[model samples]
Target: MLFPLFFMLMFPVECLTDLIEPITGGVCGIMTPEQYSEDLYMEDEILSSVSLSIKESGLNDVSIAPGYGRLLTMLATVSKAGSILEIGALGGYSGVCLARGMKEGGRLISLELKEDNAALARRNLELAGFGRGTEYMVGPALDSLKQLESRGERFDFFLIDADKENYPVYLEYAIRLAKPGAIIAGDNTLLRGRTLNPDKNGPSVLAMRKFNDMIATDERLISTMLPAYDGLALAVVK
Candidate 1:
């Protein structure tokens, strides 16, 4: 009985870390594994039930955790954002969050690479009643962003949460697309705790470090990194 209870107690912790590991690399300095798991589960439940048909598409796991979702909503509302851009549309979970906080007559353009993922995202958004407000572009983000730039499209808020290696390149494009005073946020900047140690030396970790250093030194934007959900970097375009 004692052994069984002990196993039960430890199981959730392992599960939570496993869930977050893909994004955070199991590095959460501010929150305990149990706390993170509990919080993430609650968040997942809320988003999962939002009438999004794609809710059952296994894309919810690709969405931002609850804490980051809330933050995105708040920021969109606070900025009175009418135009938004997202580099990644993984399952449309974050798209729903951003759309919910959008001002009246707001529009969001989300880019995704995989056709199946785009379709799933569309389904999710439609289910959430956010489909009308979002445009799902199925292709590489770089190509899509270039098209937007060519069309002279600009956004009030931008969120970057796509490929790890493309962060800096995304930053450049985001900077070009943003209006002055617009907020640009990048997810997973911490790369788990590997960034702090510096010795682990994975490609993602190295990319994050380079991006962090670049952001810190950049004069065009005011930037800060938050330790929320594997780490988020927030920058306000000047």
Candidate 2:
């Protein structure tokens, strides 16, 4: 049932290819990303408020796009994830999205590097009604991942959107801590399309390419990369 629902929700994304098939003068389909967000992607107004606050606070606008937020919610919901681990928490925008998909009593643990960022995330999550079931661990995410590993904590779903260079490590930790059949998702896997450039050999690009390869060839999981919105990599633990 969940798979069916997931596919139904993905119909729009699937049709996207054909939508721009007749690429007249290289223009994308009839809708821009903003238009798609406004028309097709349903976002919570609290998210709007969060975005505004982030801008007001002069914080880096690193939050996921609205359509991507909707994607996170749908993935979490369809996976029936009881426990979620988010590797990055930017003002709790993604946290709220994941929390909205949780079954009653589902737990969400977020690992953020900066104390200020985590603090803002906590406050925003509280405002979004997810404070009770969400946990925030500030400092390096790799350290937190190690701690979670030591504690033998397992998650039903994991979302990685942190530093690009550590993506492989994060993916490994996520797999190790994942429950069987757990879903592992990575945002920005395309690394702003640097992974596709033959000339760009930055550390981030190399790491992202390796991460994508692992997701594609790893025998322990079945995965696919959605080549939109900075690229979202999704895999299921075998």
Candidate 3:
């Protein structure tokens, strides 16, 4: 039968694992693709709800990847962030993750360029049980940052995932708005690897390159670039 042949062909899976183990230095020992997938999408009920909300709101195109969400959550948790500011609020997926990772009574403020996206994010945040400690502001992120600055608001963490052309400006504003020892993160820093090609690099890539260079050279911060999930740039203020 076809099933018997298929089982026989797949039966010696451990042999493949053993072969790869030495090559990978025992990293993924005997784990199948399915197991790897489970590891990648390590979500509980709230994260699942946030993901479902993003899908239902038709915001999959702008939603953060699961791995990126986990990274944000881990950073928030590690920092014990009391005040988080997010530059983009697409469907509230990342906001929910950050809020969930915050210390008890911590607050998150998200800025969205579109009113509809802001509403969608507010709804999604409420659905994800972040209705209490989150706020969605509809405006240009730079303008919102100015307002927050005028109001003397300082954040413990900042997440920048908005228009790429303004990444450097965002970093400047984030630096101004950050508290001492705050963590700032920027998404999509690699721009699909176009930053390397001078002729091919567009405004976004060039701006991101400038942003990366600034962070790397800044004496006031410690920073690193993560190669995964389209490149994440993280900096800690001194």
lDDT (Cα atoms) of all candidates against the true structure? 0.81, 0.86, 0.84
lDDT of 3 by residue, 31-113 (tens): 54434655867777876776677677676556666677888899899899999999998878888888878989989999999
lDDT of 1 by residue, 78-109 (tens): 99999999999887778888988888888999
> Which candidate's TM-score is highest?
2
lDDT of 2 by residue, 182-237 (tens): 99989887777788889999999999998999988999999998877688899999
The model with the greater TM-score, 1 or 3, is 3
Model 3, C-alpha of 173: deviation from truth (Å): 0.7
Off by over 4 Å in 1: 1-46, 50-60
Model 3, which residues run further than 4 Å from truth?
1-41
Model 3 scores a TM of: 0.81
Candidates in descending TM-score order: 2, 3, 1
Off by over 4 Å in 2: 1-30
lDDT-better candidate, 1 vs 2: 2
**What is the Cα-based lDDT of residue 41 in candidate 2?**
51
